[model samples]
Target: MDTLNSGSGKLVGLSFEMGPIRPPSEGGSYSLLIRVTRNCPWNQCTFCYGRPYDHEKFQMRSVDEVKADIDTAGLLCDEIKNVSWELGYNGDINTQVGTALIRRMPQLGNSHSFINVFNWLHSGARTAFLQDADTPIIPTPRLVEIIRYLREKFPSLERVTSYARAKTIFKKKEEDLKDLSCAGLTRLHIGLETGDDELLWKVKKGVTAEEHIVAGRKVMEAGMELSEYIMPGLGGRAMSRQHAENTARVLNAINPDFIRSRPFTPLPGTPLFDVYMNNELELLSPHECLEEMKILIAGLDVTSRICFDHFRNPSYLNAPGQLVHLLKQDYDGYKLPEEKGSLLEFIEKGLRIGEEKFLKTESYQL
Candidate 1:
C-alpha cells in the first residue's frame, strides 16, 4: 500500500475490493463489508437473473487475497483513528474527522472502501458482512480460516454475517456447518423467494422447498441465527395463494430467527421482466399483494420475527396524504405467535385502506 503524508499524519492508499450488494439490514447496521466471492454461484433465478452483479460469472477469492483485504481494512481503520487523534478528537471517529480527512485527500471522497470503513467505525464497529451473492460455497476450512483471521484482526466485531443459498447449505455436511459456526459466522441470509414447488421451478432458484427447510434447520442447529428472505408477489397472480401458504408452511417447519419480506419488482434485464412485458406473468395489485401477505402471515406458526425491512414492502397514503408503511421496517420486526394477531390486524388495515391508496408493485423497479 502506498502512503501519503498530510501534515502531521499519514493516510494509506486504503483501496480494497467490495461486492455489489448486501442485505438492507446490514446496510442499516453499517456493517464492515468484506467480499469473499465475486458473484452468485447460481445466477439463473428468473426473478433476479444475476443483475446485481451485472450477470458476471462467480469466482471465490483465495484465502491470502481475502486476508490482504482484511489487513487493508484494519490499516484504514487505524489511519482513521490517527486522523481523529491528530484533529484533537481523542481517537474518536465522527463527522468532523471524516470531513477533515476528505478535505485532506479529495480522492477519498469517491473511495467506497474508505467510506465503508469510516461509517463502520462511526457505528461502533460491531458487525461485519461478507459480500457477494454466496459465501458458504467456499471450501469449509478456507472459509473458517478467513473468519478466524477476520476476528483476529478486528476483535471488536460482535457478529459476522453473509448471504448463502439453501442448496449450498443443504449440500454442506453437518460438521462443516458446525465448524463455520465455531469460526464466528454468527448469521446467514438465505433467499427463500417462495415455497411453492411450481414457482420455485419456474424461477430456477436451483433449490427445492425441502432443501430450503433442511438448510434452514441446519443453520439454526449449527448455532447461527438464520434469516430467511421471502419474496411477496413472486408468484405473480397465478400462484399467489400457493406461494403464501406454502411459504408459511416452510417457515413453520424451520422456525428461523428472522422471516424477511422482499416484495418483488421485475427489473429490466431479468427473464421475469420479459415475462411481465410479454403479459405472461400478472403482478398482484397493492391490495392483492396485501392479501397474499395476509395468507402468508396467517399461516405462519413459527416463533421467528417477521420483518419488512426492504423499501419495496407495501406502503399506503394516510388520510392526510402522508405515506405510511404497512408494517414496521425494522431489522428486528414483530415476534411471531406473540404478535401474530397484531401482524394480521396490520394486514387488515392495509386491505381496508384499499388498492388506490397503496403503492402498486409496478410503480417501482429494484
Candidate 2:
C-alpha cells in the first residue's frame, strides 16, 4: 500500500515553489532550489504558511539524502537536456545554462530552475538555499561544511546564501558570522518588516527594534551583503503615523545596504488574515500607505540605496525614480504627475482658502 509514486522516477529530487508570497532575490535567481530542510524552524510568526503542514519538528536531511536528491536532479537535468536537443534548442550544453532556461519558461512555474537541475545532474549543486525560516540557526561549522561541499561539488558557485533571523545573528558570536561568510555564505536576507516597537510586537516578530539595528550592523560587519525586507503598512489603520515615523527611525539606525518595500498583504490562513476578515486589523488604504511611505522616506537620514522591488506594491514612491518626486517638496505641497501647477498653489487652494473644493479636483484619491 505504498502511496508514494516511486516507480516513475519523475518526482525524485528536491522540488521547489516560486509563488505569490515568496520570490527569488534581486540581482540573482536560483535555477535549482534544493530543500535541505523542510518547513520553517520558527512557525510562531503571525504571518506565514509554514511551507509544510506541521512545523513543530524542524528537520534537516542527511548529507546522503541531499546527495541522493542531487543525483536525482542530475538525472532529471539530463532528461531535460535530451528533450531540449530533441526539440532543436541549442543552449550552453551545460547545467547552468539549462537552469537559466528553466526559469524563463512559464510552464515550469513551481519547479526549481535548470541550474538546480543541472547542478544536481552534473557535479551537484553549486549554490543552495537552506530551507525553512532560519538556516543560520544551524550550527556554524555544519553550515560551513555544507557550503564547502557545495563549492567543491560545483566550482562555479560564487555565492551561497541563507535566510537568517535577527535573533540568531544577535546571539551568535561575531567570529561565527565571519567564519560562515568566509565559508562562502555570501548573503543574508532578514525580514525587518517594521522598525516600530509596537508594530513589531503586534506582528509577533519577537525581536526588539534595537535588535533589528544591532543584528543588521553585525551582518554587514561580518562581510556579508545584507538585504532587509520592510513591510510598509503592518501597523494597520490606527497606527499609520507612528508606523511611518518609527520605521524611519529604525532604518536610520540600521543603514542597511538594501531596503526592500513589501506592501502588507494578509494571506488567508495567517493570523493577520483573520484580523483583516474580522475587521480587527484594519488596513490603511493605498493613499494612506503612500502617506506613511512619504513620512518614512523624508525621515531617512542614511544614504543607503532603497528598492521598491516587489510587484505587489502599487505606490510609485517606492520605485527608484519615484522617490525623487517625494524629495521635491514637503508633504503639504505634494503634487502628482497629472497636476498642472506647483505644489504650493495646490496647498494654498486647499489649506489657505476656504476651499473644500480641492477634494473635487483630481489631485487626491482619498
Candidate 3:
C-alpha cells in the first residue's frame, strides 16, 4: 500500500507532521505555510490582495484551528515517510525533500497527492506564516503562545515571520514588540510601499513617512529582522522624485536589514486599478521605473543590503552593493555584468528610450 494513499481521507486544514507550505517571496524562500492568522488586519494598501476570502475585514485563525493544522502536518509526515520507503526511495528522496521534487516525477502522478502532502509536512517547515495582512494586530500574549507552541512542536524553528502595517507597529508599544521578539517572533515584513509622504497619504497607507522609519527602527531595536518591501513605481509619473527621495530618507533613517525592491504592478480591482481605469493615474513604464529606482538607490545612504530579487524588476539597475562597498570606493567599481550601464546612467538612458519591453526575448536568450 502507498503510505501516501493510506491517509487520503484526512480533512483539509487539518494538522499533519510531514511536508512544507507557501510561495517564495522575491528575495527569500517560503516554507510550508502554517497560516496562523486568517486575513489582513489593515486592508487599506492599494496593491494588496488581502485574504483569499475577504480583502477588507481582517480575521484570524482560532488557536484551536492552528493547533489542529500542526497536528495534521505531523501525521502527514509519517505517512510520507512510509510511502517513500515502500517505493525503495528512502533517505534523501522522501516527503522531507519537498513537493517540487514529487511533481517532477511523472510516475508519481497517482501518488502525487500523498507526495504533495508529505512535501508540506517534512520540508524544514518550522516557519509559520501569520495570515491576513497585518498579523501584528494579534495580541502579543496570544501570539506568543502560538509561537511558543510551534517552537515546542518543532524545536529547530528558524523563524516565525509575519506582515504588518507601519501604523500597526507604531500603535504597538516598543515593549510589546520586544516581548514578541523574545517570544521567538523572528521577523516582520513591512510594505513600506513608498516612503513619499504625499504618495503614502494618497495611497492610504495609514501611516506617515516618519511612522514607517520609527516602526522599522523599533523592529530592528527589538532584535527582529526587519524586511521592508519598497515598490518602485508607487509614485507614478507625477511624484516619482518625491517618492524616491522620501523612500531613501526613510531607509537611511532605519537602515533596515533587507530592502527588497518590489516594482509596483497594479492589478485590477484595487484603488490603483480604478485610477488606471479612469485614466487618472499614469503608471511608470518598466524603463521609467528603472530610472526611478536608480534615483532611489543614489539617494540611499550606505547601509543595508539592497535586493532586486524579484521578477518584475528591470535588470538595468541593481543594488550595486553600494551601501557597504561605495563609501570606501566610489561608483566606478559598482557594475553588475547583467546590468547595462552605471546605475544613474542606466536610469537616464532608460528614461530617454521611453518604450518598455519585458526582460526576456529570443535575442537575449543565453
**Using lDDT as the measure, which candidate wins?**
1
For each candidate, the alpha-carbon lDDT, in order, equals 0.91, 0.61, 0.64
Cα lDDT tens digits, model 1, 1-366, are 113243413443667899989999999999999999999989999989899999999999999999999999998888888778767788888998888787768888888988999999999999999988999999999999999999999999999999999999999999999999999999999999998888999999999999999999999999999999999999999999999999999999999999999999998999999999999999999988989999999899889999999889988888999989889999999998999999899989888886898888888885
Better candidate number, 2 or 3, judged by TM-score: 3
lDDT of 2: 0.61
Among the numbered candidates, top TM-score falls to 1
Judging by TM-score, tell me the better candidate of 1 and 3.
1
| Candidate 1 RMSD computed on C-alpha atoms after optimal superposition onto the true structure | 2.6
Q: How many backbone clashes does candidate 3 have?
A: 28
Pairs with steric clashes in candidate 1: none
Q: Model 3, 219-281: lDDT tens per residue?
A: 999999887889888778899889998898998898887777667766665777677668887
Error of 3 at 346 (Å): 6.4
Error of 1 at 147 (Å): 0.4
